[model samples]
Target: MLDRGTTSDDDDPPLQKWLARRGKMSALSLAELESCKNYTFQLGRGPQRCSDVPSGLTNSATLLKAEKNSPTKEGLLASAFFASPGDGKGKVRFLTFLHQLGDKKAVVKWDTAVTRGMLYIQLPEDPLHECSRDSLVELLDVAEEFSSRAIVFFSKKRNDMKQLVRTFKFIGFDILPPSCDWIPTSQEYFFMSYEFG
Candidate 1:
């Protein structure tokens, strides 16, 4: 029989223990995002550069120009730049997970407002890759503590749309109706949201 440790620290709640056994998720600073060599998002067009702004995700001209020109003031000028309405009341954070060996596994751009939140996943180059379920759950757990709901948007034309939809639904997100007034109407994309009680 397996020996379950008896120490109080070892007796972490089921969710905490499960999360601890998987991997660590933490916020990534802007400098870290810029330094991450493995960061890439495969948009059907091709693998986009790390500095490229995710389509339909931001309207910040500063972020756009910063991402376009390398070694520019992107780090300084865009550090505090708010990209979405969500940023008006709160801050934007980049979260990532690293494996036991410190290899980056996933990255998420998170924007939080007083009551609303959003997530933008940076897809890996590997077509078969997906963020680990544990990591996503941990992210949701964190989001739940702050926002009443979390939202995600996906382009209809994405190659992984089917898989992404399934994954989000598996994690408790529901497809938002086309008439949902919380999000801006866009013909090119669909939205999903997870409401916390």
Candidate 2:
């Protein structure tokens, strides 16, 4: 019935207990974003080298750049960049575009929410004062193209767990449980997640 911490279902192999336990286990640390202003332009993209950035989401950039040739910094559609603050509530710069990931079809919209844990995504309100419908559709299409299977998380305030769950559900993404942890740091933490296909 059980293996280690995992339980076996009638149709599935013996459940790996550790997997079951850790499956929903979340770790939170107060991470302040480092700035991208200093990032170098590689083939027209900022911070061209993934190794230069911190671990975690930076690795995803490798795939991002590979899929779309370097876009002008000013021309970048959507992105989440590190904030300059070293501690206490860092900021992330998220830019939106017509068709961000280079896909020519399908429109995708952007939404933001926060989880109780430290992980977080930063999403500001619409920046463009007057964008053309074609421009907006193009941005949405690009979002759909780049975010084939990716998920994003945001935090507006601290310890709003219920808000997090509601946001997750609103976005139609699956929620794993009990993985949230609060680790204090010099700066405030933000919850973030991205699912890659």
Candidate 3:
């Protein structure tokens, strides 16, 4: 766990800035951290499968399938998988978080091919609030380790877009242009990215 003591500096890391923005005086602690490539389907079809399973973002079909079957909403398990190119050649990475009681907390998907990682999904139950600031900072640190940039897409239908955008900006993510060739563009979603040194 990283320490968040009450200290001020001219060069505080983004995590410190975010923690200060949250206005919490108490130190934040993270739950146990875990990482793996294997994920057992919540529906329990069989043994744990590697993150390289077919249900990845390799193609439109697999991307849709992965979205349709995503377990992020259930909060049952923190699972992640990498989407490689169709030729089955690409780097893969994943991260998972477990609570002190051993319950799953969050899952983050990372893609190294583009040198940009996406926060594919997080726990629907606001794991960030439940787990506190350290967890989010830890995720960012992992993302920085994996790629030069990190991105997340937000649905236009969300009513809290203003607040969400503000919070993201406060933590160092920049709102990207409305159009992006890498993703299926629509009027429904906006993108944001955080650059790492």
Candidate 4:
């Protein structure tokens, strides 16, 4: 049997559950992409690192990760500096987890959901301090070990909960209107998970 697409039934559920915890979702909806300017205007009206950008999806194929411990910021998102699905809605899910003061810290959750015929590895978690160079190397190694797979990073910095909400809403997720307790700086909160890439 030819194994098509990224394989990781073990990791996706926990990741999905973690994402669900971060945001409130009720069914799926598609976005109404009115115009190019309009789309670009609301791309990322949230946190700014002065370097983060979106990386549009290209079949979810091979993804490249930036150097560890390096001050440089590049290749961070599928279409942005965060780890999220770029454009469209359909099956998109919003991760709206809130981070507590101390207990809520960043974590990594990577799994491959590749094309129907090929393989690709996606790091669907926070790239915080926990993800050391060695850990990332190990993750890449795991991907290489699979021969047909490529490991990718979904950084938390550019892909905070707020970004998720906005991105999801843009893609037509059943996101509730932004409230004070859930808006403004709420994106800065930590929605830490126990898992690591």
Best by lDDT: 1
RMSD of 1: 15.5
Candidates in order, TM-scores: namely: 0.43, 0.25, 0.43, 0.23
Q: What is the C-alpha lDDT of each candidate?
A: 0.41, 0.27, 0.37, 0.28
Number of backbone collisions per candidate: 0, 28, 0, 13
Q: Which ranges of candidate 4 are over 4 A from the true structure?
A: 1-107, 115-119, 125-127, 149-197
lDDT of 4 by residue, 1-197 (tens): 33322342322332233223212222222121110001001111223335355433111112122111223222322322222224221121211111112223543334433222222333445433443333334443332322332323233466455655453344333432334221122342332111112
RMSD of every candidate to native, in Å, equals 15.5, 16.0, 16.6, 20.0
The residue ranges of model 1 lying beyond 4 angstroms of the native Cα positions read 1-128
lDDT of residue 77 for candidate 2? 20
Prediction 2 global C-alpha lDDT: 0.27
Q: Candidate 3 on 65-107: residue-level lDDT in tens? A: 1111323322212212234224232223233332221134443
lDDT of 1 at 26: 24
